[model samples]
Each structure stands twice: as structure tokens, then as C-alpha cells.
Target: MTITINTSEIPDTATEADRALKAKHAAMWASGDYPAVATDIVAALGGVLVDTLDIRAGHCVLDVAAGTGTSALPAARRGAVVTATDLTPELLDLGRASAAEHGLQLSWQVADAEALPYDDGAFDAVMSAIGVMFAPHHQQAADELLRVCRPGGRIGVLSWTPAGFIGQMFAVLKPYAPPPPPGASPAPLWGSGDHVRQLFGERVTDFVARERSLPVTRFADGAEFRDYFKRNYGPTIAVYRFIAGDPDKVAALDAELAALGDRFLAEGVMHWDYLLVTATRA
Candidate 1:
């Protein structure tokens, strides 16, 4: 269970996603009811966490890079004492609202994933759904995840499956919206989920990788999706700025999604691919 990251093709400069990750994404999440979208995404992957981590009631859980608490809320409901930590404050704002609405109480902290400001072995399990992939320094990030949990604790992570339709969507998006300046490694974390266990001494006792298509159930139309990009994608704001005040942009996007629906959508399912990673610490 050796996890060796392949970063040869990644750029030396912080790829676009690092700098503008939160601000634009928060804006998009605010524009539309992204909480509903988050709920659906979380539901699609919930069981994997339950089985893989053996998460039980009253377990102390640390969700690093916890975005919108999609996984945190479920883990809390399972009776795990959850601390949802993220780098951005505004994201915490969103996570707080979502948690309250669900009647789940989560300990929220604003902190960096690489340099966690927590006591060692503070959590029984650590999970970061779709989080570590965004780390500029993948190895450092992995080390931190392992460092915070007690001996033999569990570590579960989610990553995006690269080169699928979602990959193509991101590729198509870079031109429309270039990523902001990077902070740590200056490289975009692309194609990283393939092998990550070696970074943790191969202690991932029960490892399972899953792929699923996330259907966007609530988007009003492609225009709505495009609006979502402004908050979620690294390059959306710049792209939006370039085409700002254009009345026809929404119409053009609607047409594009309608055309894509013929091939990708079936019965209103806008398929998005993602990878779910689960492991244990030795």
C-alpha cells in the first residue's frame, strides 16, 4: 500500500485553483441554493464513509478541508463528535448555516490543512472529502493528516476522478477562467488520487475507491450552473469578468447545456464523476 504521487506534469507555479478557490466559490454557492447540491453529493457518498471508517457514536472526528460540511453533518448524525476545519472563514460561515439548518452541532475552526493547529492525536478519525487533491504540497498535507490522528486511527479522503467528463469540463473552463496565483507549490493538483497511501506508511488497512456520477438536481438551467462556477471553480470570476454585463451569456450557456443533455444527461441527471478514498492509520 505505497502511495507515490505523480506530480511530474504539474506546473511549478501554483496553478490557478490555489489563489481564488474560496471567494468566487462562496459567491456562487450564495447565488444558488448550493446546500441542496451539497446534500445530494454527500448522500451519494455517505455509506462509503460509514463502512470504511467503522465510525461509531461519540467518536472524535476531524474533517480537514471540510467544505460546506457535506461529510461532517452525516458523520455528526452518526454520533461522531466532529470538528470541521477549513482555511477560509467565509466557508465556515456557510458550513455553520448548513449545520444549524440540519440541527447538527459541529465544532468549526478556521485553519490551514498543512499546518494544523491541534493537539497531536486529537481525533479518532480524519476525513477530507475532495480535499487533499487541492493541496499544493500533497506530501506535506498527507503527513499532517496522519500526524493529527492517534495511533491506529482512521483516515478517509475523497478525490476527484481525473480525465472523465468533469475533467473535460475543467479543461474547457481554464480558458474561460484562468486560475489565480498559487500559494504553496505553484502546481495544480491534477490526477492525484491514484496512489496516496504510501505517504502514510501504507497503513490503509481497508482501502476502497469508488466512482459515482453526481446528478445536479436543482440547477435552473445551464446559466445557473455557470453562476455556480463563479464560486466553486478557480477561474470563474475572471471568466465572468471578461464577459461581464453581457445579456446573452446566460442564453448561450443554456443552449450549450441543452445540447450536452442529449449525450450526458438522462432524465435530468447532470453526471459528475468523483473518487471516494477510505483508509486506516497504522
Candidate 2:
């Protein structure tokens, strides 16, 4: 029996499927205790963005997908008028508490990267550290990043490269994780310089990209690294929980990830490489 699924029907179906997938993605992130894992690793990257952009005291800064204000609070400390936005209300609340602890005053908003709430040209510098790349609609997210920045203002991004350790981790987890919907771009594409150029085409100037390494974890061995991620990282935790009923699959994934960790382990630490992108709004 030949099942000739109508090709024309696929597009609409795929669109709806992708929309549902995005909602699932949001819920997954919201489910886990991400700040418990992300805080230490992301905090330093925030400082890097602030330094790279040379953000001045009077600059207006917006940190989109600003999980727990990793980059936002640092910018505020540098005296910029900063607004941090993220989809997760819990993360935003944690960011607010952190800012208060530091005695810093900054606005926080629950926002979606693809549809920013701010007016055009409202910010002098916009940044995200390992954040915005997760948006399901990459082009729309890129458009919003450019739209909110003033002409000549900077956009700084830190993304996990498709070839980097973190990227490889996702590759290793592919067999266990549910596949993304057809036509949905993978998040790691944002780490590719070519993809970034394509995404920001004609919308940016002085575009610059550099390969940077950040220490994501320190472990005595691959087993320790695997155990740490499985316990702490949100995506890792989510996947493991999802496959809990399949013990064989869970064991397989754990073993694969442990083996994958060997490539990055060096002298008791695992360093992950990422792409740092900066550009001026056109």
C-alpha cells in the first residue's frame, strides 16, 4: 500500500507542529531549576560582554533572554541603564533578588525574544550570553535584536558553536531527545559565523566574530562531568526525566555523554568553546 502524503498539506501541518514544539521548549526550560545550574557559568560571560562592548555609564542596555540577569546586572554595575528581559518569570524573579542583593537598580521584564516589547532604537547596546540562540524562530529573534538597538549601537552575543564541546553534547544527546520539528532551525546554527552573517544580512555593520573558550565545568574525570551535567543542567535533567521510563535508553545516553566528555576533559577541567559575535546596528 502506497501512502502518498500530500506534499502541500505538510507545510501547514509542520508550522503548527513547530509552534507546539516551541511551547514545549518553553515549558521544559520553565520546569527545571536553571538558575541553580546557569549562574556560575554565565556570570563571567556577562562581564566579558560588558568589556567587549565598552559599555559606558550613560549607555542604555537591553539584555534579551537575560537568564537571571547574568549580563544585565553586570551592565548595571558598570553604570548603564539596563533592562533585562526573559520569558521565564522564575528566572526573572531570581534576577531581581540578585540585583537587590547587590544594591543595583534595573528594570526587569518578562519578554519573548522574537517579539520584544521595547520601541525601536531604544537601546544603545543589546546583549545575550548563551541565551537568544534558543529561540525557535531564529530570523524573528535576530530581527528583534536589531530593531531594538539604536543606529550605531552594538549587539553582543555569546553562542555555543556547533563544533564546540557543548554543541557536541547536544549531538550526543540527539538520539535520546525528541527531534525538532521539520523546518525548525537548530539553535547551534547561531554559533556559526556564516549563519550569523546570513541572519543579520544588511541589518548590521562592523560585524565581528571570534572564537572564545569558557570553562563550563571542572571534573576529575569524564564520569564526574557526566554526573554533574545530568544532575545540574536543565536540558540534561529534562532529557533524563523524559526518558525515565526507558531505563536502557537512559543508560545508553549516560554512557554516550560520558564518552563524549573525554574530548573536552583536560587536567581536571572541561572547557567549552563558543562564538562571540558583535555588530553595530545599521
Candidate 3:
């Protein structure tokens, strides 16, 4: 199957800076085999988010920043009309292939979370699992999520919390990373209840939040975990790419990431924490 990505949907009003940042984002995610990481580690969270939204047959659902349709596929399985969107076309292409293999019908589109192309209130339930949170602008992404859902419709987000395994991993990588785009907040802030509420700001109500841990037993130890992420996770791979010229920096990163994994490991498993938030459009 051939996959074509049309960037015509991007808002003409978007600044050149925004376009450049998004391009970098697309390349970073496309650099590594993210689908493998998603399938192996956090696949179950998709179903969890789908159930949280109580998605019913015929409901229109949009999965923002959906990488490989984790939550989107489950929602489609439940008979919801699902459209999965991501900034990286490569990921969306893989997702489309997976959907075909499973005989699940859904639409996959290349989209920016901060500026979604859909009309306001076009969906019954809008969601993102370990997605959308990575958008450069949190408030813009939150506004887009709210804007796309109908009144009283459900909106759900699942993200890695600031104190979780994924978050700590980013922390270890931060010192070696380049400066972020202007006005962009940390992605993990979406995992915080207060931060999310502040972003939505009375535009949504009946908010509910929970923290859950995904047990990881795939790695025997910290070094193995570090090696897996370096090969399969885009962000980790991106960090390595930036520091590739300096052997000392690369060695430092390797040591720090491995130590982080070791600290999180317990009894042959590491539990990664994530925040799940559900709300209704006002």
C-alpha cells in the first residue's frame, strides 16, 4: 500500500518558525521504529483510554498525535468511527497498515495537534494516548482538542507524568539536548492535573484524573532498557543523534539513562507511570 501525506491542511496562517519546528518533530519521530516501542510497551493504555471514554458505535472519534493507532484502533474495534492523526506520516502509514491487517476500518491523516484541520465540534469523543502531549505548545494543543469535540462530548488524554519513568528519562537527556522552540513548554506538563486544567480553563468541565503504572518486564536490567530505547524510541534516538559527534557526551548520556532505568527497576519489572485525564466539553 502507498501512503501519501498532504501538508495542504496546515493552516496558512502558521508562522515559518512553527513550520520548521514541526518538520523537526516529524523527522525526529520518523527516525526510529516507534511503532515497535508502542506495541511492546504501552499497547494496553490505548484500550484503557478507549474504555474511559465509553466510546460507542457510530460515535465520531479523533485520535490526536496517534502513533500507530494505539487508542484509535481499540476505539475502532468498539465500532466508533475513528480517525487517527499524527505529525509523522511514517507512523500514520504504519498505523494504516496495521488497521488493514486487523480488518479495522479507519482514516489516517497527517495533522498538527496545535492546529487540527477538523471543524469545531466535529467529533463525539477526542483522545490521545501518550500523544498530543509532545506538541510544542500545550495550550494550543489543548484548545484544539476542546474545539474539535461537541458540547458534552468526551475528551481523554493519557500522558507520561513528570515524575514517571519516561519523564525521568527525558530529564536525564535534557542537559545534552538543544534548546526548545520559543514558548514551548515541557511535554510532561500535560500529565499534571493542574496544568491541564489551567490550559482548558473553564472551557471544559466534569474533569477526572488518575495516575496509572504500566509494568515493564521486557528488559532484564537498566542497560538493556537503555539499549532498547536507543534503538526504538524516537526521542532517545534524537538525543543520541544531537550528541553523536562527541564521544564523551554520548558516553555520559548512556551512563545516565542506564542508571535511571536501574533506579526504576524492581523485582524484574519497572512500572512506568502515566496520567489519564477525562473531561466533557462545556
Better of 1 and 2 by lDDT: 2
lDDT on C-alpha atoms for all candidate structures: 0.63, 0.82, 0.90
Worst 10 residues of 2 by lDDT: 1-10
Candidate 3 structure quality by residue, lDDT tens digits, 1-282: 122333465456679999999999999999878988888888878799899889989998999999889999999999988989999999999999999999999989888998888877888899999999999889889999998899999999999999999988888999999988789999899889899989888988899899999998898899999999999898999889899999999998999989999999999999999999999999
Give candidate 1's error at residue 219 in angstroms. Answer: 5.1
- For all predicted structures, in order, the TM-scores are 0.71, 0.90, 0.96
Error of 2 at 227 (Å): 2.1
Error of 1 at 64 (Å): 1.2
Candidate whose TM-score is highest:
3
Candidate 3, residue 281: CA error in Å?
0.3
Candidate 1 to truth, TM: 0.71
Question: CA lDDT of 269 in candidate 1?
Answer: 60
Q: How close is candidate 3 to the true structure, as a TM-score?
A: 0.96
Candidate 1 runs further than 4 Å off: 1-36, 39-43, 46-48, 101-103, 179-192, 198-203, 219-224, 227-235, 242-263
